[model samples]
Target: MVPISRLTVIAATVVLIDQWSKQYIQGHMLPGMSIPVLDGIFHITYVLNPGAAFGILENQRMLFIAIALVMLGLTAYFLKHIPEPFRLMRLGLSLLAGGAIGNVIDRVQTGHVVDFFDFRIWPVFNVADIAIVTGVGCVIYTLVFSTFPTGNQENQR
Candidate 1:
């Protein structure tokens, strides 16, 4: 079984970093402000998202919060069933939980998520978003590539 301490540490790290970065952005930049990190490529643009990814369902803060909480709960419930030594799965779930909580904090406190890290081609996003997406990708990778030992297999061992 995945160790709860390890999972908690990973999640806490992500939340801390996400919150710190967002706070820094909020203190340093105004909404709609942009600072070029890479000419015409990447930038630090501060924006407040009131809805989900890609700015969809705008102004639906409560709905997004509810969804995130449910997802986090389900992830925790499933994590227990995954066999041990599955580091990637643990990391994935931890990051996912961290990111969700980070955004939830923002929604509860300000009714919006603070986003930065602009790549001119895509909608602006923040550290928490990165963690969430990365976590999901990791989870998908683990599910596709890792083989979990079944009860029968464990019994044989």
Candidate 2:
């Protein structure tokens, strides 16, 4: 098991980065504003998501906030049991924890998650969104492939 202290550090760092960047973007990128970073592919656009990804359940800020809180609580409870030195799993947890709290901050302050990274082909997103997506992917990979000796590992005694 990796020390909980180290996990706390990682999670804290991710949350800081995620929250700081979101704040910066929110101040600079006005709602419905778009600044092209790479023509035809990427841009920075400010959007407020009151729902989950892809704008699902729009205007359900309370529900989204509740869900994020539950996710963070569960991740915190499960942190100790998660196998250590497992880079992917660590990263996944960091992402999940950081992203959840980051958005929670938004819900408390703005009643929505501030999103700014806009791709022409997809929904606008921010650092928190990136963390969540990548973290979820890492988790799925760990579950499907790595044999870490956690409860999820069937072979673990």
In terms of lDDT, which candidate is strongest?
A: 1
The RMSD (Cα, Å) of candidate 2 is: 3.1
Give all TM-scores, in the order shown. Answer: 0.92, 0.87
lDDT per residue for candidate 2 within 75-146, as digits (tens), equals: 888776776657687778878888788888888888888888888899888777788888899889988897
Against the unseen true structure, what C-alpha lDDT does each candidate score? 0.90, 0.81
- Candidate whose TM-score is highest: 1
The residue-by-residue lDDT of candidate 1 on 22-76, one tens digit each, is 9999999999999999989999999999988889999998898899999999988
Candidate 1 ranges beyond 4 A from true positions: 150-157
RMSD to true structure for each model, in Å: 1.9, 3.1
Candidate 2 stretches greater than 4 Å from native: 148-157
